[model samples]
Each structure stands twice: as C-alpha cells, then as structure tokens.
Target: MHLTLGLHRAVRHEPSSVATFYEGRTHTFRQLADRVARLAGALRTIGVKTGDRVAILALNSDRYIEYYLAVWWAGAVVNPINTRWATPEILYSLDDSQSEVMFVDSAHKSKIDELREGSTTLEHIIYLDEEEKPNGTLSYEDLIEDGEPIEDSYRHGDDIAGIFYTGGTTGFPKGVMLSHTNIGVPAMTFLCEEYGFGSVSLHTAPLFHVAPLMYVIAQLFNGGRHIVLSGFEPAQVARAIEERKVTDVLLVPSMLHVLLDSPVVQKTNFSGLRRIWYGGSPIAETTQRRALEVFQPSGLVQLYGLTEIPVVALLSAAWHAPEMRKLRSTGRAAQENEIMIADANGREVPRGSIGEIVARGPNVMKGYWNKPVETETAIRNGWLWTGDAGYMDDDGFVFIADRFKDMIVTGGENVYAAEVENAIAKHPAVAACSVIGIPSHEWGESVHAVVVLKPGAREFTVEEIRHHCKDLIGGYKSPRSIEFKPSLPLSAFGKVVKDELRAPFWRDAIRKV
Candidate 1:
C-alpha cells in the first residue's frame, strides 16, 4: 500500500503527462519520480532515516509536490507547517514531531532562522525558491544536483506518512499521525467514485492542509494534472480555470462565495469545469443553488470531512437534488467508513436523533503525536469521536446540527447556535456569520452571533436582524445579541475561528478543565 506501487504504476502508464503545474512549469511523472528519488537520496546522505520526521514550511509550489514523495521515499515522517499559524504554534509542532530536516520556501525564509534556533530536533533547513536561495539555509536545487537515486527506505501502509497538525481544545496544535493507508482511503474514494477524476483540478486549497492534500494525492494516483496557485484569489482561480480548462475544484465556502460574486468569475470561461467540491463550512442553500445555476451539472457536490477523519461523507452530483438542495447536511457515512451519532456516554443514537458524531475507519489518524492520553480520549474503541453534533435520517444522510463544542448550552436547553446563525445568514444583507456563546447573567450562557454584512448594504441595527431571525427560528434559538464585524476571522481553509471568537469571554473561564 506504499505510494510506490501507485507511483510506479503511474510512471509505466503515462510518463510524459503533466502531473504538476506550478509557476508556468509542468512536471511529468518521469521527472517527478527522478527528482523525488534523488532528493530522498540526498536526505539520506544528510542522515535522514526511517521514522525520522522532516517538516515542510511552504507555499503551493513545485518543490512542495517534491516534498511529499521525497519524505515518503526516505520512509520519514512529514510535518507540513500551516502557513497561517504563528511562529509559536509552528515551533510547538516542530518540537513535538521531532523533525530533523525542514524545507522552508522563500515566503517563509525570514522565520526559518528563528524557527530553527529553538528546534532541538532540527538538523538542517533547505530553502525552496527557484531563482533565489537564502545564504544560511541550503538551496533546494543544490541538494538535488546529480544526487544518487537511492533505494526507497521502506514501502508503505500503516507506517507513519505525515504528522498533520490540526487545532485542538488545548489551544495548541496536535500532530495527527496519518499513515499512507489513512491518506489512501480518501485518495481511493475519489479515484474509484468515477466523478471527482478529471484532466485538471484547480488547486485553490493549501497543499499543506490534509483536506486539500487528499485530493492532490488522489489526482496523482489517477494521472490527473494539478493546477497549483500561490494562494487563493478569486481572480487567479477564475483565470486559471479558463486558461488551463480546469475540470474540477475543491473550494471553501468563502472562496466560492467570493468567486460567485466577482465579475471576473461571471465573465471568465468555465466550460471545462465538471466538478466543484464545496466544503470547509456550512454553505447556505441560497448560495449553493446560485452556484448550480451558474455551472449547471459541473457545479455539484457538497463534501463534508475534517482533517482528523476526512472521509466523513461525500455528496455526489446526483444528490445535489436541485429541488431540496439541503445546505447544512454533511451527508452520510462514506462508503469506506461508518459515521455514528452517539450520546455523551458513546452509545449510538437512533436515526433522526441529534447527538455527537463519531467515526471509525482505516482513514482515522493513528493518534496524536507523543500524546497517548489525548489520543485515547479522541479515538476510544477505535472510533474517532469527531465532537460534531449531527444525526442520521432514515435515508442514512447525516445532518450536522453543529459541533459539540460549538453547541451553546444556555440556561437548561441545548441551543444549536447554527440554527440561529442559519436564520441570520439567510437574510439578504448578511454575507457571512459565526455563532458563539457569550457569558450571560440570567441564562448562564446566552447565544451570540458575530456577523459580516455584504458590501453595498446600508446600515442595519442588531435588533432589526435579531427580529428577522425570530421569524424563522424559535425565539430561544435567536442570538441574544449580535456583534457586527467587517468579516469573521477565518482559517486558511476558511473555517470560522469559533475559539478565537470566544477567547475574550473565556480568558478566565474554566471550561471542562
């Protein structure tokens, strides 16, 4: 189940096809394989060994593609640093993973000196810029110059592949030990599904993020070309889709929303795009329907999965069901895994009953790196308790109520803040919204909504908006108060930072400690 079996298969079938496109350069499988081998050999020369950790701090570039195969070829663990993370978080992950070598792109070169200084496990830093290489860090090109194509250190399966870091309740990043098999589950799902495959996939999501990386790995296995961009900009995405005749894309709700509203998006050609997998947040039905009208059948699918167990469920184009177009449902258990909604005690809940959503599958993370207790708490009885609150319909479709952590308990009733937020978001003027629980004197915890208004809207009061929401949802579910902001804080993948939203209120609060 190692990547080579697939890599060698790809090389034999189509060696000359463009596998990666970045910075106006295309890399064929033959060339990529060669580079990966030589880089792995060079890493070995630098004393990298099996189970050793190598980290990559990069933007979406050709070297980033090489980073994946090279680390796996050397049988070393990969820890991809989040571009959005601050230095302290990045330092924490590097220290925790015990990474020996780190590849920092030109964009992050300035921080390399500081990051490397405090990392006891880090032995070397390689700068990955095509033209300019920093002085202190070794050049990526120099290291690969005519290095021997060393034999692969080991084949893959349950072996450690990547130390993928995701946010935690502890407020520190936890490295999720994702094996080759773990990634392969999502890779195989898209490949075998017969829908997600294409000649080109618009790589708008960051490659370091596991949710997006799942598609990148799948594209490689399927011989599809990846069109990489430095970052997500609506103009770039629209232009790339037209220029490359891009056929599929994985986009967050924010990007999708921005693109749909951009003039370039409407004017630019998108005749070739066959699939658009929108996720990373609860997409409003109004927006989902508008997308379908714009792109037709190609504008299909609303997939739901977290980095922890990314293969939660997939909604096919057929299920887009123009009529129903249910926006917030996360779909059902993926064909490869079981998704269960259980009570706090972990007993399975019946259909249509709301509870905590958990999953068990080959795709689940092995554990949090070096934190057995945290691992045990997350993956009890081989099930990855996702901490999302959702329920199954008789049709087996999973409907997400809200995250268990995001569920606001006000007074005695458990109010799903998402229901209230949905009511608020559906308003014509509301562009984006996040629901949170703020401290309250009477209710103990009162529902609060932080909202962003669309451009061109006139000033509106919070009471006016709260009154509009009460018309749709129950009064109790309506936000006790609304906070206006230009935009909600978002992660690189565009997930709302609920933790950051509540940080001020929670500064001295003891929550489940």
Candidate 2:
C-alpha cells in the first residue's frame, strides 16, 4: 500500500472526524480528502506528471500537509526545501532536484522573487496563503476550487516518493532518494508500536526534515488528528498543548530544553500528553532528568537515525525512567530494522567497542540521487553505513558517542564531542554547549568548547569549567578553551551545527574532517 491509502481509509472510516487543526480553523477528514484530491488534479493541470519533482518551501501548516499528500497523489515526487537554508542553498537544492512546481507560504513568499531569478527548472509558483495572490503566482485555494478530483496514482513499494536532501553542513547537499516502502513501512511500524487510533498529534517541528515528516506519516496511518503550528516556539507549543490537548509531539533535544525551561510550560496542563519523542542529537542527562520532572505524565521516547535511514532504533518510554541506567543509551535496534557496529574495514565489532553504526532494513533509502559513487560508498551488501560513532552493550543497547566527523583527536587520544558536551551540560550555569577540536602546536589538536549559559547565569571562567568537567570526565578530555555565546547555531530540526563551530578554527587546515 502507498501513503495515500491511509487518507483513503480515514475518509472511509471516519469522514466526520476532525483531521487537521491550524490556527482557529478545523477541517474534517472528508473535506481534507476532497482538498487533497482536487489539489492533485490542480497539480496535474500545471504539468506535474508522474515521477516529476514538486518542491515546497513553507513553515509547518495544514497547507504543508496537503502539499505532501497532493504531490504523492498526483504520482509526483516531493523535495521539501529546508526552511533554514539561505538563497544559495535553496537555489542549489531546486536546481539539483530539477523541481518544476514550487509552493511558497506567506512567510517565505519574499524568497520566491529571489528564487525565481536563480532557478531555471522552477516553472510554476503556487502561493499558499490566505492573502491576495502574488504577481505571476497562482493561488493555492483557487487551484482546489477550480480543478476536478483525480484518481489515485497507486504508486506503491519501490516507486520513489521523495528526494530528501542532506549534508548541507560539510558540503553540497545530496538528495537521498526515499521510496514509498522506505518511508511507509517504517511509519506503519512506528504507528503500531507507539501510536494509537484517534490520537491528537502536534506538528511543531519543521516538515522539511525527515523525522517530523515520519511523525506526520505515523499520525496519518493511525487516523490521528493533527494540530499544525507555523514553527516551534516554547510558549506557543505549551499553549497549543494545553488548549488542544495534544497527545504526542516530536521534538529535538534543543527544542525540548527550551520547552522545559519556558515558564509557560509549568502553568500549562500536560494531562493529555502521552509521549514526547526526541532525537537528532544526544540529550544531556541533566536536561533529561529535569524533563522527567516537568513532564511527569508524558513519556520521553528517544529516536535515533539519519535521513538515509529514517529510524534504526528507538529508546522507548519504558527505558526512559529516571531510575534506569540505560537512559543514556540510544536504545536497541528497532523491530523493523537491524543495527550493527562496524569498524573501518566493514567488519562487525564486538560489544563495547566504538565504531561506525550500520543499519539494514526496508526503511533504508534507495540511494543518493544522481550520485552513484557516493551511494556505493554509503551502502554495501544491503547495509547502509551511517557515519555515526557508537557502541553496543552486551544486552544490546546502543550508545551513540559522536558523529564520525565530529571525533576530536587531542594529543593523540580520541575525544568524542558528545561526551565532552554532555559533561559541560552537567554544569548548572551552562544552558548549551558544543565541543570541537581546534589546531594546537603542542597537542596537535586541543579540545575547545562553545558554551551558551543559562539566562541570568553567573559568569563562569574557563578554569571553572575545566575543573567541573574533570569531575565528570577524564582530565585530558576537559576542554582546554571555552568561549561563551548567547546562543548556539541550530539547524532546522534543532541539531547543533558543529561544522559551523569548527569552520573558523580550521580555515587554513588544508582539510576539514
């Protein structure tokens, strides 16, 4: 079955049920299905044929959800642009993916003029806003009203559904080709394992990212209601949860920290919240413990994976108890996937040994779009080599250490940045921190940290930080240098951009790892 099948089932099973909530408006399943079908027909009228690429650059909204379903219903592929990307990055993705039709919401309409000038393949621009149509663009609402409903394309199994781009940090973004099965199967598995029918799921995370998109699919599969927010703000999220009685939400660790810290959260009612899923980066133990205290009724679930392979493992709610020592782990392999730690030679490593994380399953992407060599290097013998360093315990729990590229070699010893960052996070004054290796004449490379202190926190000296870290980690692993900033640079999904932190120090280093 394809993704659209869920929509069809929802329409048949519960046509009168509320399907989506945006702002102060609500849409029933029947109305949503009709809009989706008409939007698909409208897309066809605009020359979107099967296998064509249609891109959307918008904040999270009901329109964004419609954009996803309509594109697939029309038998076209989706290329969701990262909302955090600048003009150059946006242009590169549009040109690289060869997207023909573009959708822009009111918030991002300004970029359309600039994007239109640089994009050669973007032929049609559809405005997704309630205001008057922009010059040279068709209104999204008009398309649904004027066009006729179309039949489902029934694109199933290996048919490509979307081309998700990755690697904007290191270099050019490569479109990772994900098929209908690659996404749908895993989403269904997650739905059965974690979600329940008629649940209310909140969409505050960016839809451009794979994790949130997967959550969207899971909600659809379970016939759950969706409450879409334009973007993530801690206060807004808390307000939405209290008002809408949202059952589940998917947030990165950074977003969780902000939400837990927000005073609005303490006053908001979390009685309806069932689960809070977090991932994209390792969360500090201190933050996790505090989260447990604040969100008492809500279970915290940790998901671990990359765009290439959506979710390889999950730390379930059962493993998140405060008393559980395994809370630090990324958890065991997901039921639908297999995870293994492999050395550089592609040989499996023993438990408790650090190595690259490799996964094999139906959830793995087909390959990198238009890059056969890179695809070959990434996947071998049916296993996708995730460039993440981690170790498995004897009981089969996986603990992520760091990304392969983020490993810091200081004085000939390996220092995983996550470990150092976790130690720094334990310091009460620190709100957020990122650890990286910097060039040093004496040590070859020295451990350096960029920290963001909690608001109104007293100033901390480098020596104080070093001493505090010494108590948690090895003295050698303590950061030799510390720089404080008001905030850290985060990606659309809330993962810290370590490469950005490492760039200035390594500009003349001939190579960046």
Candidate 3:
C-alpha cells in the first residue's frame, strides 16, 4: 500500500478531526490534506517529477509534516536533512542525492546562501517560516495559496520513498534508500500492536530520524493527533505533555536523561502520558530507575534498530518494570522482523554466543543510495548485517553487547565497551562514561575509559574505578586508564562518538579501528 494511504483515509473518515497541534495552532485533517495537495501541485509546477528527490531542512512543526505528505503526494522522494549536521556534511548529502529543490526553515535560513552556493544541483529553495519570504526564496504560504489541489501520485510497494542519511561518526554518511513498503509495512504493524485509533502522540524527537518518522506514520495510520515541538527541550516537552494530554512520546536516552533531571519535568503532571518510547542508545540502569520514579504513570518502551532496518526489536513496557530480569536486553525481534546472531562467515551462532546481529524483513531498505559496494557488504544473502554485536538467549531475549567495531581486544581477550561502561555507570559518582581501546604495547589494545562525574561528586581515581569494576566484570575488562571529562562527544542520535575519543590515543598508531 502507498504510504500516503493513511493521509487519504484520515481525510476521508475524519476530515474535521484535529490532525496537528503546534505552538497553540491546530489543523484538521481536511485542512492538512488540502494544504498537502496544494503543496504537491506547487512542487510539480516547479519541475519535481516522479522519483525526483525533494529535501527539507527544518525543525519539527506542522509544516514539516505537510512537507512529508506533500512530497509523497507529488510523486517525489523525501530527503530530510539532519538538523545537527555541519555545512560540509549537509552539502555532501544534497550533492550526493542530487536533490533539486530544498526547503529551509527560519532556524536554518542564515546558512541558505552558503548551502545554495556550494550545491551543484539544488535549483529552488522554499522558505518554511512564519515571517515574510526571504529575498531569493519562495514563500511556503504563497505556494499553498496560489497552487491547485492535486490527487495523490499513488507511489507504492517498491517505489523509493525516502533517502535517510546516517550520522557519519566514523566516516561520510551514506543515504539509506527505503521504499514505500519498506517503511509503511512496519508502521502499520507497530500501529496494530501498540497504538489505538485517535491516540494523541507527541513529536519531540527530530522528524529527520527514522524512529520519529515511524511513530509519525503509526499515528497517521491510526488517524491520531500530532503534537509537535520545534525541538526537544525538557521544559517544552513536559509542558506539551501536560497541556496537550499527549498519550505517547518518543525520546532518545539522552533526552530522557535530561527530562528526568529537569525541575520542570518534576513539577509537571505526567498523569496524562501513557507511554514513553525511548531508544537510539542504551539506557543506564541508574537513569532508567530514575525515569521510572519520575514518570510513574507512563510505561517505558525501548526500541532498537538502525536507519537501514528500522524497528527491528522493541523492549516492551513489561521489561521496563523494576523487577524484570531482562532489563538489559534490547528485547526480542518484532513480530514482523527476523533476527539472528551470525559469525564472521555468515553462519548462525549458538544461543547466547555473541556475534554480528543480522536482520531480514520487509522493512529493510532497498540499499544505500549510490554506494553499490557498501550496500553489497551491508546486505548479504537477503539479510541486513547490522554491525551490532549481540546474542539471543534460549528464551529469545536479545542482548546487545556492543558495536562490532567498538569492541576492545586486550591480550587476545574480547572486551565490549558497553559492558565496562555499564559497570562504571553503576557508581554513584559517575554520570556518563565511554570506553575505548587505546594502543597498548603490552596487549595490542587496552581498555581505556573517559568518565563524566555527577555534579558535586567527589573526585575519583583510576584505581578506585578499576576496583569498583573488578567486582562487576572480568579483570581484563577493567579500564586500565581513566580520564575525567565534563561530557563525551555524541552523535546526532546520542550514541557516544568513540572515534573521537580514540583519535588522540591512536594518532600515531599503525592502524585505527
């Protein structure tokens, strides 16, 4: 089925129902559909043909949702730019995708000239702001006002729907090409399982990310209301939840951490919230415990997946209970997805044996855009080999150990950074920490840790940390070196950037992982 089918259904059955809520403004499904059709007509007028790429660089808003449906309605591909990326990274994606028309919001308008100057193919720039149009850009309102409403293009099944760019922590970002079925199927499955009709969902996470996009799609499938925020701020999220009576919301672990610590969140009434969906990175046990205490009424659900294969597995709300034993696991694979632990030769590993986590399902992307060799390497024998190191138990619970590339080898023994980081995070003094392998003459590679202490916590020494970890993990897994930092570098999705931590230590090494 077409991804835009949900929009059509919503407009047909609930045309007068509220579709979106943004900063005190509301739009009904009828209004949203009318604007979407007009925007599609406007895009077509500007030479956006079937399969052509249209990119949006904007924050979360009603207009952003309109941009998505309008692009699909225009028979074009949606390429949402990562809002946190640098100019060079953004330029690379636009140039690589050969996107012709770009949409810029007020927040990013200052960089428009530079982006346009650096682009070789970008032709038109549409301004999506409340103010008057910029000198060289077309007004978003003008397009909707002047253009005529058009019918849906009906792009379905294998038609390329989106080109989501992964955060390039190790190197340049590659665009993951997803088809309409690739995204729509999983969305429908998720909606059937979790969300009910007319649920009120909040869009606090960046819409550029696939996780939020999937949630948005699920809401659309259920004919639910969307409550959008420009960006994730703890105060604003809490306010939106209480004021909008938001039933469900998605957040990364980092955002959850900030929310749990915010005084505004503590003061806000969380009784209206029914679920808190979090993922993108592992949640520390301490942070999870605090979250459970802060949002007592809301059930927490953890999701695990990548841009290539969205929504592979989900740790259900039952597992988030304080007494649950499977809290450390990312959770079993979703019903629609098939996951397995594979050895280097693409052989399935024994139960409880750690190996590369591979997944196969309709949700898997077609391939990486313009990167044939990388696509071949990623998807072999119809399975998307996620570079995550993990294992499944006899009962089918999946525990993610670490990224295969992030594994630390010391004296021929494998040490997963996540294991050591988990141990360090248990300490009351520790707020955040990241483990990496550094060049070691004695052991080829040694475990090193960078730690961020909780505010007003006493200073901790390397020996103290090693002693603390010795009781929890193997002696070899203990961090040999420790450095205190206020914070660790994070990717757009909140995963620790291990490459940055290893850069100085491996600067003179013969090889870098």
- Model 3, C-alpha of 434: deviation from truth (Å): 14
**Tens digit per residue, CA lDDT, model 1, 1-513:** 676555666789988888888878888888888889999988988899888999998888777878988888988888898775556667888888888799998788788778878787888998888667766678788888857888776657899888887655544556888988888877777775564444688787778878777877877777778889988888998899999989889887657767888888668888888888866655556677778888765757766776778778887777777565444466767778988889988899899898888988889988988888989998999899877777888877888755566556553234556556667878998899888887653344678888888998865776787678654554655777777889888999989988888888867753310
Which residue pairs clash within candidate 1?
331-398
TM-scores vs. true structure, each candidate: 0.80, 0.81, 0.81
Tens digits of per-residue lDDT, candidate 3, 362-449, equal 9899999998988998899999998888889997888876566556655434466776787789999999999898866435567899
Best-to-worst order by TM-score is 2, 3, 1
Candidate 2, residue 490: the lDDT equals: 96
- Model 2, range 1-513, lDDT digits (tens) per residue? 598877888899999999999998899989999999999999999899999999999999998999999999999999998775556667878999999899998888888888898898999999999799889999999999998999989888999999997653234667999999888877865675668666899999889888888888888878889999998898889988989989999887768877877889868999888899887655667778888888887888888877889888988888888677888788888878999999999898999998988999998999998988889988999999987788999989988765666566543244667767877889998889898887664344678999998989987788998878764555767889989888889999999988788889978753333
- Which ranges of candidate 2 are over 4 A from the true structure? 168-170, 406-513
Off by over 4 Å in 3: 168-170, 406-513
State the local distance difference test value for candidate 1: 0.77
Q: What is the lDDT of residue 255 in candidate 1?
A: 71
Which residue pairs of candidate 3 clash? none
Every candidate's lDDT: 0.77, 0.84, 0.84
Native RMSD of candidate 3 (Å): 11.0
